[model samples]
Structures are given as C-alpha cells and as structure tokens.
Target: MTDAILRMRGITKTFPGVNALADVDLTVRRGEIHAICGENGAGKSTLMKVLSGVYPHGSYEGEIHFGGEPCRFTGIHDSERHGIVIIHQELALCPQLSIAENIFLGNERAGRGGGADASGRARHGRGRGGLGRLLPGLRLVDWNRTNHEAARLLERVGLPENPVTPIADLGVGKQQLVEIAKALSKRVRLLILDEPTAALNDEDSAHLLDLVRGLRDEGITSLIISHKLNEVLAIADSVSILRDGRMIETLDPSAGTVTEDRIIAGMVGRDLEHRFPPHEPRIGEEVLRIEDWTVHSPARHDRAVVSGAALRLRRGEIVGLAGLMGAGRTELAMSVFGRSYGTGISGRLYKDGKPIEARSVREAIRHGIAYATEDRKRYGLNLIEDVKRNVSAAGLDRLARRGWVNGHEEYRVAEEYRTGLNVKAPSVLSETGKLSGGNQQKVVLAKWIFTDPDVLILDEPTRGIDVGAKYEIYSIINRLADEGKAILLISSELPELLGMCDRIYTMAAGRITAEVPRAEATQERLMSHMTKEQEQVG
Candidate 1:
C-alpha cells in the first residue's frame, strides 16, 4: 500500500492571457499538513481551484489521483462528494443564518417530515427568499437532526457557539471554525484552507493553527495556502513552493531545511536580507494634533467608540496606533478624518499649529488630509472601475476643466503613480478587481496619494499582502515620510509597527492608555497597555 493520498500530475491551467499553472506536480502523504507558499499572482489559488474543481475537469489539462483512484471532478459538488472541501479566505457564510442552518446548507439532507419554523411556514434551511428556493434534490429539512449534527460538528472543531447562534454574532475566528465544522459534516478527507488566518488576529490565528494540528492527528490531511511564512513554518509538515506559475521545490521542515528565509528565496528568487527598509526619520514641528477627540457610536447613540483620544503627528514622522480588535483604532482614525465614521463627534484639530475644521470628506481632502481605509475591498477602491478612474477619484478637481474631467490629464497622473509604485498590471486600464491584493493595495495608495495630502492616515496599510509586497509598501511609507508628510499608521501587527513607527501609542477601551517610543517599545509592553482596561475590570 502507498502512503500518498493525493497526487496531481502535469496540471496545466490557463486563463485568457495568462498561464495560471504550467505542468505542476504535487503530492501529499496521508495525514499531513502540506502548505503551498508563493508571492501574489504566483497561481497558488488558481492551482487549488483546479484541484477542487472550480475550474472543472475539461477546463484544465491535469490528471488527479486521490486514494489511488483517478478523479474527474466537474464542479465543487463533485469534489465534495469525494471528501475534498475548500474554504476560501473571504468565507461563504451568510451572516443572517444560524450556525446549524449554515453548516447544513447546500449539503442539505431531506426528510419526509413537517419542518415549520416560528412563523408556521416550512423552514427552508434559513436561506434567503422562501422554502421554494431549497437546493434542487433537497426538500423538507429535519431541523432537530440538523441542529444535533451541527452541535456535534461544532464540538469537533472546538467552537462552543450555540447551534442556533447567528453567524454575524460570531467573530471571524469562530466563523472559520464553523466553516471547518461544515466540512467535517461532509466527512471530509482532504481539507484545503486558502489564506484561512489572513483576516484573523494573532490569538485567533494561534487557535486555528492548533485546531489544524488536532485535525491532522485525527488522520485528516490538510492543504493550506498562506502568505504568512512564519505560521507556515510553525505548523506545516511539508511545504511546496510555487513561482511564476511553476512548481519550484517542496521542502520537509522535519529535516530543518524549510525556513522563512529559504521559503522567501524560493518564492521571490532572492534572499530578502531585510523585511523592512531602514529609515532615518527627519522629525519636524507638529503637523497635526487632536485634543479631547471623542466619537459616539452611530447605531448605539450612547456608546462612546473613541473616548478622549489625544494624539499628535509631527512632520516626517510615522506614528503607529496599536490596539487589539475593537479597541477603537479604526474608529479614532475615521472620526478624525472628517467624521467618516461614528456620531456625536467632538474634536479639536490643529494643522501646523493652526486650528482647522474638516466637517466632511471633501473638506478633509481640501485641508490636505487623506484616510486610506483598512477594508480596501469594501471602501477603498471601486473594483469594477479601471486603475485610472480609481487613481483620480479623490482628486478629480485637479483634472477638472470647466466642470468636465480631462481624461488625458487623469490618465497621465495615474500612469505616473502606477509606474512609480511598481503596480504589476497590464496598464492603467485594467480593472482593479482583477489585480492581485498587493496591486489593489497600491491602487488604494495611489488614490489617496493623488490628492497630494500633507497628512495621511493609513489603517492596516499591509494587511493581506505577501511579504515582498509588504516590503514595497513599507518603502512607500518611508518615502512619504521623507517627503515631509506626517503619517498616522494603524495596524494590529506589533512587529510591523515596532519596525516602521518612530513612536507607538496603545489604545484600550476606546482610550489612549500609553504612548511608547520605538526605542522603549516591545510586544509585551504594547500588549499589556492594549489590554489595560480589561485587566483592570477583571
């Protein structure tokens, strides 16, 4: 008997102007955590899509063998029937559905029984619309059995949420567990996670990795696609590297050869001597300062999202706001940037020691202030629009002539930033959505940078991009600071802040708890200050 549970030979996949995968060969031994590592657009996700039948059988040239049996999966359902399930990073859960309903969704089990919900109508698996919209072969869900099975699966994944809990109520980490629980409900044999923990905080990431380990121990094989090389090094039994749509090499960490450095060398074809570019800040007079800034929640009228937040940014200085999730970092930044978020806002803003008021986004831009949102997909860029439109969106007035936008000037400005930022796209006409995460991030930066802002507030500037892309973004930030632009950087990654910021401020319970200089900062100290309110209350 052979130990291999999965084997794909000569997998060649192509898109309209792109060869996603080229004669790639991948093998997986039974009960092992195999990681796939690559930079953005290296075809890692495309390869997984092929294996999981997102590209279908006739769409790609490949031979797949699972459990020594030749497989021809035509769609996601076909792969699922054979115990292969993939969970994408964005998550497919419907926020309004209950845990049990989402777990049993699509893979619905029918019964010859009445399943009337609270309104006395036939419960249709908590799907939108009505009961008539159930999946084609599935009718009449047995709610009792569904809830029981969901509870059992939840226990297996170590999620203690009630089966009836709405998916929106749980955090991203718990939502991930529910996804795995759904996979287990299908009796999954080979599980694939595509950038599973990219959105999760550190504690949640640790829990998810531990759960993957536990699942591996139970004889389940896992394939993880991640940009986080450190996490891959910690959990992967074997790692496969992909570059330029070709298989480079697979390394076994058990033999002590697979390291972050080794993996980076393979992914980018160079030794990344430094993850962050060194910088010497040219500190100058205070560019912007906020005194007694407080913002109440819009939904909850009485709740103070940002309470008495006081911070200052100096010319050519990068200041970091470090906090745990919901600690008011984003809220503070948004409210200060012309009340983009929060309500009942009270603040005093000064620029270059002169008082200024920006009551709207337009006014903020007029005052030479720009806010780059963390959720780039949602608020930053119009994904359907091309690069030129997004780049000139914030500062359209500059290209406007007699109430009409000069397309020629807009294109010129966008092309300049595109070349300067090294945005890897065909041209300024490519749709923003089609580009990779790193390039999309550059577009977001280009949008704000076009405004020619003197103060830039970048929230989670490098959240989901690869390390190489992150280095590029860091260099951009350094260049901005060198140009005498005061930056307020907000990030959850402590190492990133410690490396890039000249000073870091800790916030907890919506209040600025401590301001620590980079020379005196450590992760432990930052964490302690971040949880100060919780510690005091407990």
Candidate 2:
C-alpha cells in the first residue's frame, strides 16, 4: 500500500475579489521532503496557511487528512496538538527573548512537584491535572531543564549559539535555525517551512537543506515552499508545481523528468527560453566612485563594520557584490547612501569626476543617487499608504508647487510608474501593502526610479520573489542599465550575479577581497574569495 501522511482534496479558498485557490488537490507521502513551487501570488502561502490552521476549519472548503484521520483544526494550537508546525517566511520569534525563553515561551515545563493542589491548579488557569501532566510541577518553570533541552535542539539543527543568547543578537541564518529548533520541540510530524532559506546565504542554506535531509532520514515529513528552484531540486524527493492558484503537476526527480526548464515551463505556462535577459551593457566613463570607505558599527564605537571598501561603477554598467551573510555588503551600501546605517562613517563619494556631498538622505537624492533598501517593508514603503503616495515619496518635491502637493501631478507620476513597471494593482489608489512580493518590489523600484537618479543601488532586489517576478525585475534592471544609469547590484544568489553583472566584487570580513571581470567570474571562484577570511582564521 502507498504511504500517505497528509492529503488535501478539492481545496477551494477565496478572498474578496479574488479566488485564491480552486479545487486543488495535494498528497504528501510519509517521511518525504515535498517541495511546492510557484510564481508569486500563486496561492502557495495561502495553501500552507490552510493546512496549518491559520485559515481555520470552516473558512476554506477542503478535506484535510493526516495520519489516515480527517482533521478539522480550528486554530494553530489545534494543528500543533496534531504535531503540525509551520515556520513562516517572516519569523515569529520575540527579539528581546533569549533562545530558551523563545523556544518554550508558551509551552514551558514545570518543576519537581509532579502535581499541584486543586486550588494551586485553579490559580494557574489549569484544569484538574493539566499542569501536572503537561509541566509536572504547577506554576513553577524549570529553567535548568529548559536550557538543557534548548541546547540539544540547537545542536541538532547545527547552530552554534548559546541558549541564553537573545534572538535580536543572532543573525538571520541563526534565527532560522532557532525556528526549526522550536518546531522540533513541539514533536512535529509534518513541518511546513515557507521560504526558510530565503534570507540565508549559500553556506547557511546548504546547512539547512542538510538538516532537512537528515530529518527525512529520521522519518519526519517536510513541506517546503521556496522560490529557489535549485534548492528545491536538490533536496526534495517530489516537486509540485502551482500556477495561478491551481495545481499544475507533480514530478519525481529520481525519474529524470524534472529539470529547471521544465519547472519554469510549468510555473509560467510557457517554455522560457532564457532565465535572464541578455546583458549587453554599453560601457561609458566612470559615473560613481568611492575611495577607502570605512564605517564603524552603530552599537560599538571601536568595531569597524566596513573598512577600506572601494569600488567604482560606470555609466550603463551593472556591477555586482557577492559575499556570505554578514560580509558587510549591505552595510557598505547603506553607509554610502547618506550614512543611513552605520555610525562614524567616513567615505568619499565622487559622481562624474566631482566630489558630492551626501551627508543625509535629502542630499543623497539631490546628488542624483537613489538607494532601494533591502528591507522594503520596513524602510522602502509606507504600507498603510496608497501606491500613489509611495511612488512620489522619494521625490515629493517634483509633485509639489509652492509648498503644496499637486494632487493631479502626484497621481500622474504614480500612474506612469504603476503602468510602466507593470505592477498588478487595481489602480494607483490601491494600498501598497495589499500587493504580492513581486508587485511590492516593482513598486519599490518605481519609487526609486521616479526620483530620476543617475546612480542606483539595489540591495537583494529579488528577495522572496518568484522566478517570473525575478525575470521581470531583471528586465527592468537591464533596461535601466541600457539607459546609461550606473547600477550597483547586491545579491545572495551567485547565478544571478554571474548572469546580470559585467564585473563582480567579492567581500569577506568587511573588506573587498577580490574583483573579478564577468569573463572570469564563476560560482566557485566567487565563493572561494567570499570565505577566504574564515579559511585564514581556521
């Protein structure tokens, strides 16, 4: 008999003015790593939310079967009772809490009493012996046991961090490991990870995939939603394609039928001939140059975050920065952009053979430089505002007359960008927060592009976006470069760097380690330079 751990039959989910999912069916075998691939807004995350009880039992029409028993989960806690845990793309850990505290935050173990008096149990909001069975001791948390268990879980996830470390102090990769460890603590049977490796680098992503493989070997089932096709192909036993809120097909990679091209065809509903737009940069004189740039840490005065980082970008040239996480690429970019990030920043920025003063964001914009921040939701856009406001946010002066915003001009600018970037929205009046990842990124680009900058810095431009959206963004980048705008691109994906950049610079330990021309750059060579500092330390 075929072993099936979970099944969803004829699932139909709908939201206002949108049918997100329609009569979709999915089955995951026991102890297997199943991958879900789709274009952005294809209902991947929505489906996972339904499976994990985020949408509740009666909200969506579907039959969800787990372990041969139909499940009607009313809430997340209900799903957790059945050993189903979901780690979302946006992490849910409290930054101020320590690792142990965050892991056992809601599910804490009790002390040595084993059971408590009726009055004691009532005081702690527990039924008859609820505290005794769940915690062993009533109203008393066991820190020793908590730390010991937390340490073990961390070790299993291959994270080298103390249990007492604050979540805010940890990097994005380590935070992801902690999320997995939290899931492990819950006796998870079917773990759902949505874009777990989206924020991670090559080494960290590799380690996470290894952990997933080990879990599969240990008979734990995983359902991963990812945009990185290579990772999905590498780790998943079976791959399911989703397009426009419908199931396309599921392929077994071991049967030699699964390829990136085939998957792209399924996702886009077309055989995409090329993953990237052909880059034929028309080289020109140097447009932007930085000399001996250095920035100190914001938290620590003595620590240097970026030191002696120097680079140059010419008109119509797209230059890429490749490095591991925490390699200071983002920091360098932010520091240069009006010192928006680090403290004690010392950098000499030259534009078109002349030194420019960009001590603040206003001056930076005035100097014809624009920065599309990495954390778009946090820094790039006002989520509560409409698309019209967000598009003119960076260049409000252009839409103002006599210290007053010209409403018609603002709408005109936003509509031009909205239509120009092909952002899928009802109108310029639509809320920016309501758009999907790909559309949101396009809006961010529209905001910066509206500023009419001569030089643009894009940080992780395609992060958390689907393949189709990535191709669109790449086309926009190529278009901008062709227009003689100097572009500085930073990306975690090596293939993206190799495909889009004319020259690639490698960063390690806050310094530029090597600069490779496009003709000589490869993944292996870039990675070698990226980890040189760690190798030297070892």
Candidate 3:
C-alpha cells in the first residue's frame, strides 16, 4: 500500500449547464498541508465538496481511497465517519448556541438509558433494527461531560474561550477556532478549510496559520481552498492549481522559492503584471460632504456607533476609508447614505453646497447616492433571484412603467452589465446564488451603477475575490471615477486602499483620526493613525 493517506482519482462533477469539475486528481500524504488556488469560479470549493460527500457518491464520478481503504461516503456524516470534515468559507455556527453546544450540536453525548431499555440493551446490545441501545429519544444530554470534552478540543485549537459562552460574543477569528474545535470533536484526520483566513486581520491570520501548522505536527492532513496566494505559498507543502474546472498542475513550494507571480500565472493563465490597473486621478469639485455626523446604536440608543465624523467626496475622485474591522467605517457610510443604521442620528449632509436630508434608503437613491454593503450575500443581493433581478435591484424604477415592471428591459440592462463587467454566469436567467463571490460582487456593482449615482460608497468591494478578479474590480472603480462619480472606497486591506484611492482617511474608535493624500499614505503611516487613541467623547 502507498504512504498517502488520501487519494482522489478521476473526480468529475457537473451542474446544470456547468462542468464544475472534470477529471481532477488530488493526493495527500499522511500529514501535510495541501492548498488549492484558483480564480473565483474555479473548482476549488466544488472539489472539496466532493471529497467531504457534499456531492455524495452517486452524484459524481470519483474513486476515493482513505487510510488504505476504498471509501464510498454517501453524506457528510458518512465522510465524518471516515474522519473527513470540511469547514466552509461561510461558517456554519449557530450564533445563539454556546461553543460546546455548537461543537456537538449533531453529535451529542447521552446519559445512561432507562431501566427497561438498559436491561434490554444488556440482554441484546444491538437492539431490534441492529441500531445501538442508545436511542435518541432516551438519550439525555450529559452537559458536564460535553463541556469538559469541548474544553479539551478548544485547547487543541488554541482557543481560550469558555465552552459554555455563546458563539455570538466571539469575533470572527475566535469563531473560526471554535469551528476547528468542532472538527477535532469528530476526531478529524482529513481537515478541509475553505478560505480559512479570508475574514481575519493580520494578527488573527498569523495566529490561525500557526494553529494549522501545529495541527500538521499532530499528524493531521489539511487541504486549504484559498484565493490568497501568499498564504498558499507560505504553508502549503504541495500547491494544486485549478482553472476553468480542470486540473492544471501541482507544484511543491518546499522544493524552492515559489513566487506569488508564478501562482498568479497558473491561476489566471497569464502574467498579471499589475495588481491594480494603472490610473491617473482627475479630482474635480466636491460633490458630497458630511458635517458633525453622529449615530447611536439602534439596539442601545445611548451607545454611539459613530461620533462627530466629517468627510467629503469630490467628483472624479476615489477616497479610501482605512480602518480595522469595527472602526465605524461601515457605520459612517450607512448612516451618511440614508441613516440606514443606528438611532438618534445627527448629521448634516451636503450636495453641491446645499444641505439635504436622506432619512431613508429610497431617499438616498433619489438623492443620487448609492452604498454597496460589506456583507453582499446578507444585505446586498437576493441570492435565489436571477442575474437580471439582482442587476436592476436598485433601479427597478428605471425598468418600471408606473406600477408594473418591464421584464424585457430588465433583461436588456442586466445583459449590458453582464457583458461590460465580464461577469461569468451561464446567462441573465442564472441564479445569483450559483455565481462566484467575485461575479456576485460585480452584480452588486451593476445594481448600484444602474441607479446612476453621482456618489458611490463601496464597502470591502474585493473581500473574498482572487487577485485576477481584484484587478478587474480596480479597473471598474477607475472607470467609474473617470466617469465623474465621486467614489468612497472602504477596505480592510491597507495595500488595496493605497493602490486605488487618491485620498485616504484613517478611523479609530468611531472617529476619523487623520486624512492622508495618496502621495503620503503608506501602510505604516495609516496604521499609526488607525491605532490612535480616541477621545472619550460622545
């Protein structure tokens, strides 16, 4: 028998009108970190889903050998039985549940059975249907044992949270650790992490990476699906490049110094000379300005989410908002747009030197302003709907004749953007849920663009997109700026803001600490301002 712990041969999966995976092969040694890299629509997630039995045995053509045994897993539970567990990009944790409960939600520990059942089980351990004596109905949860085991698993993943604490209280980074703990609960041998650190900050990402390395030392085989190439080159012992639903090639980074440029070439099938499209900014007159903006949290009306913030946007200019995850960048944008968030909002909005009120989302759109949400799937687009509906979501009135909508016009408008934005979908009729993260972002851009807004507020526009798709988005932003739209770009990545914005503002503790021109902004300088201590002001 070979030393490999897992081998997938001739894996092919197809969707309606889409061949998601075709003849893909992957081999993982007993203990190694293997990374899968590709563009957004590539078969990275699809391949992992096949292995974890999300596609199941009969749905795809593949032969999977695990731990020297030919395996046929019919469901996620079956794969878990074989020690395969996959943590998806969007985490599957219930916010209301405690860490321990979430970890063992499906797989629970039970107390001793009833006297009758116990006696029967003692007589015949395998009961009537050959199912175990511990029936779910008679299974009372052993909370003390559950919490104790959960703590052990949490320690293994380096999470220091109380197992009984609600998952909602933890940050995204900590929540990820809880997910790993949940995987360890299953005694997982083959762990698959999809975009593990996509939502993490630099510190948290480093911590997560270190934890993964620790897991490898413990003899666990990990397969990571990520668009971040630098991460792939850093940790992956073997790197597999997938493109257009076919296996291109696999390389060993440990053999030599494998550059990010090389990985990009394999992913996009071309030398991506520039991360951002070249642009010369043409900043015109001020189009939108905010004065003394303050917003209180809707839940707790006394707590201020944004305070005394002032900002300005000029036509043909792209201004970047630089802040950490909870630095009120989004709060400020949403409040200023239409007071969409928070209570007790006190703000002065100006358009072309005239004071204006945009107290609602509809009024904001009517005022020629648009805001693309940070969480696109949650607040931006209707995922179940088709491309045409999502594309023309914000500007339905443009396609509407009085009270009725013109479906043909909506399709025409969506098609125009689909071609212009280069969105990779089967057609305008295709469900938005089926589109990749990058393409879905384009559709969100199309929705806002269709509104013909003079001011565009983009929140983390390229959050989970690959480098190639990021370049395309940058080009789109530049084009929009060139078309004389005042753009406010909000991003967590300092480099993205530096590369794309003409002017950048750093926020700390619900306040704008500093404004740096493009000529002066650097990661270090931005970080200094972003980390500045805020005054205890309301």
Most accurate candidate by TM-score: 1
Q: Candidate 1: where is the Cα deviation over 4 Å? A: 115-139, 534-538
List, residue by residue over 1-538, the lDDT tens digit for candidate 1. 1399999999999889889899999999999999999999898999999999988999999899998899999999999999999999999999998898899898765654446432234555534445535554445677767777888999999999788888989999999999999999999999999999988888899999999999999999999999888899999999999999999999999898677889999999899898789999999999899988989999998999888788899999999999988899999998888889999999799988999998899999999999999999999999999999999999999999899999899999999999999998889999999999999999999999999999999999998898889999999999999999999999988989999999998999899988899999999999999988632210
> What is the lDDT for 50 in model 2?
93
- Quote model 2's TM-score: 0.93
Which residue pairs overlap in candidate 2's backbone? none
Instruction: Write down the lDDT of every candidate, Cα atoms only.
Output: 0.90, 0.89, 0.88
Where does the lowest 10-residue lDDT sum fall in candidate 1?
A: 112-121
Query: Which 10 consecutive residues of model 3 have the lowest summed lDDT?
Result: 114-123
Residue 353 miss distance in model 3 (angstroms): 1.6
- Highest lDDT: which candidate? 1
lDDT tens digits, residue span 1-538, model 2? 1599999999999999889999999999999999999998899988998999999989999799999999999999999989999999999999988898888879886554333221122123233464545754445665666778888999999988888888999988889999999999999999999999998888789889999999998899999999999988999999999999999999899887789899889999998888998878898999989988889999998999788888999999999998888899999998888888898888688999999878888989988899998889999889989999999999989988899999998999899998899999999999999999899999999999999999999999999998899999999999999999999999999999999999998889898888899999999999999988532210
RMSD of 2: 4.6
Predicted structure 3: lDDT: 0.88
lDDT (Cα) of model 2? 0.89
lDDT of 1 at 73: 91
